[model samples]
Target: MRLTYSARKRLGATSAGVVLTVIALVMLAPMAWMAFVSTKPDADIFSRTPLSAPEELTGGHYANLFDQFHFGTSITNSLVIAGATVVISLLLGGPAAYGFARYPWRGSGVALAFLIVARMVTPAALVVPMYTIMQNLGLLNSVTGVIVGVSVLNLPFVIWILKPFFEQVPKEVEEAAELDGLTPGWVFFRIVLPLALPGIMTAVLYSFLAGWTDLIFPMTFITDANVMPLTSSLLQMQTGYRIYWGELMAGGIVLTLPPVVLCFALQKYLLRGLRTGY
Candidate 1:
C-alpha cells in the first residue's frame, strides 16, 4: 500500500529521532560514567559495577584537584591561552578571509591553497620545527609560546571557515555604505563584520577550543606547572607508582565543562554559521 505523505513524514521523523537518541546516548555514556566516577569514593570506583549507583559520593576529589594538583592555576592558564588564541585568530583570519573573498590579487588562489595545505600538515609533523622556532624566539617554557603555536595551527582553519561567510555578504550593501561616506575600514567593520558574525562566532569557538584542549604544544614548549594549561596539567595526576584515578576523573570533568558551556552559549551562532556558508 502506498503511504500517505503525512504518514511517510511521520515515519521519517520517528526514524531520525530514534537515530539521534541513540547517537546522543553513545556520546554521553562515557561522559556520564566519568561524572559518576568523579563523585564516587575511590573504594567504590573499582569495587562495584562501572555504572552502578554508589553508596557514597564525595567532592574530595575536586578539592584534591586544587590542593594537590594546582588545578586553579591550570584553569587560568588555559583561559589565557584560549582567549588570546581566539583574539589573534579573529584579528588575522577575519581580514584575510575578507580579502580572499573580495580581492582577487595575483597568486591569491595559490596563496590560499598553500595555506590550506599548511593546515593539512599534522601537528606531530610540525612539532620539531615549531619547538625550534619558539626556542629561537625565546618563547619556550611560556604560555605565550603555546598560544603562538596554537594560533599558527588554528589560523588557516579560521580563514577557511570565514571566507565563504564573507563572500556571502552583499557587495551592494558595502557599496551603499561607501556612498554614504563610510570609509572602507568602517564599511568592513560596520557592515561586513556584523553580517558575518555567525561565522566569527564559529571561528571564535573553534580557535578557543584548539588552544584549550591542545596538549602537544604545551607539553613540548612548557615545563612550568604555573604555565601549563588544564589539558596537560591533567597529566600530573599520574605518577610512576600510582595514578590518582579519582582526581583524574575530577580533572576530566573540570576540563570538559568550559567547552560544554561555551558550546551551549554559542549553539545558535554555530548552527547558523554551519548552515549559512554552505
Candidate 2:
C-alpha cells in the first residue's frame, strides 16, 4: 500500500510513542511493585498472584517502620549527612574545579589524572582504611564522619563535572573583569559562578544522592542506632532466619522518594547542566 509522506511520518511517530511507553512501563514496574507490596497485607504480599490488586489495603508496614524500626531517625540522619556532603563537596570541589579549568600549573595534568584515579578506586577497598581512620579520630558512629567520607568520595566527580562547565565560560569575560580591578576570587564568585550555576546544581544533586543512598559507609562506621541512615536501617530489617518484606518494602519507598522527587524537581537544571557541561 502506498502512503503519503505525512501519513508515513505520523505512523512512524505513533510506533515510536508506543515503544517508549512500553519501555517506561518496564522500567517503572519494580518501583510500582515495591509500592504495591508496601501497602499490601502480608498475606496479599505472599499470594500466588503477587502483582494482583490488594484485597485489603493497609498502612501497617509504614506504621511498623516508624514505630518499631525507628525509620524516622534514619531519615533525619540521611538528610543531615547528604546535606552536609553536598555543601562540603561544593565548598572544596567547586574551587578545585575552577582552578583546574582556569589555571594550569606544574603537574596540573598529573594532579587531575590522580583525582580521576581516586574516583575510580572502589569504595569497598577504602572501607577498612576509612573505618580505621574514623575509629582513630573518634568520629565513628558520627554523622560528621559519614559526611566527610561521602564528600571525599564525591569530590573528584564533582570537580570533574564542574571543570568542563567552567572551561565553557569564555576567558575574555574573566580578562575583562580582571582589567576592571576585580580579583580572581571576585570574578569567580560574581561572574563565573553565575554562568556555571546549572553545572554546580548538578554536582550538588549527585553528591547529595551519593551520601543519601550509601550503605557501606554508614554500616561500617556506625554501630549506634541513633546515627544510622536509611540505607543502614533498611539492612537491619534482614536477619539470618527471616526478612521483614512488608516493612522493608515500605522503608524502600520512603528511602526512594526523596531522590525521585528531587530529580523531578531539578530535571530542568540537570538536563541543562549536562547539555552545557558536555
Candidate 3:
C-alpha cells in the first residue's frame, strides 16, 4: 500500500511522539519512584519493591524530615548560597558576557578562551588550593567560604551559557539607543538587560542548581554541621535516624523541586533569550 504525503507526515510525527514518550518515561521513572517511596513505610522502602506505590500513604516521614532532621536550616543555607551565587554570577558574568558579545577587542578572543579554560579545569584540582587559602584567611567551615568557592565553580559556566544570548541582541538597537543620547551604561541597563532578562534568569537558575547540588566543595570547605548546606547535610541524614527511607525520599523530592519551578517560570524568557542571542 502506497502512503500519501499527508499519511507519511502523520506517520513520521507519530513515530517521533512515541520516541519522545519513551525517553520521557525513562527520565520520569526515578522521580516517580522517589515520590512513591516517599509515602511508603520504612520497611516497604527497603523491600525489593523500592519503587512500589504505597497502599497506605502517610506524612510521617515529611514530618520527621522537618522536625527531627532540621531540614529547614539546611534548606535555608542552600538557598542563601545558591541565591548569592545567582546574584554575584549575574552581576559579574553578565557584564563580561555582554562585553564579549558586544565589544570587539583584539584580546577578546583570547579572554573568551581563558574563560573556557576555567571551565575545563577540574574542581578537584583546586580543592587543595582552596582549602589552604580558606585556612589562611580563616574561612574554613564557613558559609561565606562555601559561597565564594561555589561561585568560582559556577562563574565559567554562566559566562559560556550567557555569552551567546548576549551576542544575539541587535547592535543596531543599541546604536539607536546611543543615537537617542543614551549612554552605553544606560542602554545596557534599560534596553539590553530587559531584553536579556530571560537568558539572564535561566542562567541564574542553572548556576544556582550547580551550586545547590554541589557536594564536593561544601564537604571539603565546611566541617561544622551547623554551617553545612543541604547537599552536605544529606550525609548526616542517614547517620542518626537509623536510615529513615521515607524521610530521605521527602528531602530528595523537596530538593528536586526548586530548580524545576525556576526553569518553568523563566522558560519563555530563556527561549526568547536563546533565540535572540543564538
Query: What's model 1's lDDT at 94?
Result: 95
At residue 276, what lDDT does model 1 achieve? Answer: 47
Candidate 3 total steric clashes? 1
- TM-score winner between candidates 1 and 3: 1
N/CA/C clash count, model 1: 0
Q: Among all windows of ten consecutive residues in candidate 1, which has the lowest summed lDDT?
A: 269-278
Q: Which candidate number has the best TM-score?
A: 2
**In what order do the candidates fall by lDDT, top score first?**
2, 1, 3
**Clashing pairs for predicted structure model 3, backbone only:** 168-277
Candidate 2 residue 91 C-alpha distance from true site, Å? 0.3
RMSD of each: 2.2, 1.7, 2.7
The digit string of per-residue lDDT tens for model 1 on 70-119 reads 89999999999999999999999999999999887999999999988878
Tens digits of per-residue lDDT, candidate 2, 23-46, equal 999999988888989999999988
Return the candidate ranking by TM-score, descending.
2, 1, 3
Candidate 3 per-residue lDDT over residues 42-111, each given as its tens digit: 7777788655565778888888877877788888889988889888888888888888888869989998
| Winner on lDDT (2 vs 3) | 2
TM-score of 1: 0.92
